[model samples]
Target: MILEVAVIFLAVLWVVTIAMFMGHTKRQRTLATQQVEADSLRDQRIRELARRLENYQGGTIRMGEELHELRATVAPLPDKITILEQRDPSTLSFAQAARLVTMGASVDELTQSCGLTQAEAQLMTKMHGNG
Candidate 1:
């Protein structure tokens, strides 16, 4: 009968609509879960980068402090060297002459600057020169 066919068709349509709505809701839940995981990963990465930046900043500060200390320690060396140079030429040591030779001073320059004999200057040059 025409009435029975209409009732069955309406029932089938209602069932299909309910099934589609359930599928759509399941997909939405899956997408929400994925979004939550992505956000967590992003937050973790930000924390890691922040930790690394803190360590790098700490290292930079430590190195700066060390450089300042080294500068303070070395500040008086030049004045001491000047005083040594102004003292009596005879007071200059062979160690000073050797340091000059290693700095590429010629034998004559060594003899004049360090008041060494020509033989001593030549020996220092041969012992300490680059070539």
Candidate 2:
């Protein structure tokens, strides 16, 4: 009778040990999953900050470049127009027209010369590889 009782106790003890081990394994797995999630969130935050910084730097460079282009484009136009307007209106020459073309003047500037229009200027400029 004692032996039978001891056998039953041993079986019960084995079952309890297995249950405790299984519970410990489950807790460890849950902890590992939580740590991975935390690490992923931190990595994503770092990447986002880096992307924002890059875009800001690119925008600054583009602004400065665009401003420089505008100043260069507008600087020489007024003097060119004044020189043309001072010459005789009826006796405008091809040399003057050619000079204006070289200086990026459009057909609008040559309005008195054979009725040149914006489309004509665009066509002439494009034909001469200037547009």
Candidate 3:
């Protein structure tokens, strides 16, 4: 009778041990699955950030090229302005006379200082007078 009781106890202990081991293995598998999912999310986010960085770099390059083109287009504007000013001495004289008129200079002063005729000086004074 004692031997039968010992055998029954051993059998129950064996069964319980196997059940606990199987439960522990299942929990390990669940934890491993969670880790894999987390890693996948991290990789996806990295890829998105890399794509954004690449697009930003491309836009920066395009803007730099456009600035270079604009500089090239505007580089000759000063020379052209100088040439225009030099080509028209009469225009310079008229501009100087107008400035003088605005500063309260009379027609005689315009004629003497800016080389304008009396009629032209009078016209400039009338057109560009401060009042």
Q: What is the TM-score of each candidate against the true structure?
A: 0.58, 0.39, 0.52
Report how far off residue 75 is in candidate 3 (Å).
2.1
Query: Which candidate leads in TM-score?
Result: 1
Candidate numbers, best lDDT first, in rank order: 1, 3, 2
* Model 3 TM-score (2 dp): 0.52
Q: Which model scores highest in lDDT?
A: 1
Error of 3 at 118 (Å): 30
Cα error of candidate 3 at position 110, Å: 24
lDDT per residue for candidate 2 within 10-82, as digits (tens), equals: 9999999999999999999999999999999999999999999999999999999999999899899999899
lDDT (CA) per prediction: 0.90, 0.78, 0.88
Cα deviation of 112, candidate 1, in Å = 24
Q: What's model 1's TM-score?
A: 0.58
Whole-model alpha-carbon lDDT for candidate 3: 0.88
Q: What is the C-alpha RMSD of each candidate to the true structure, in Å?
A: 7.7, 10.3, 7.0
lDDT of 3 by residue, 24-129 (tens): 9999999999999999999999999999999999999999999999999999999998986776465446777787888899988878877778999888977999
Residue-level lDDT tens digits of model 1 in 33-105: 9999999999999999999999999999999999999999999999999997887866558898878878888
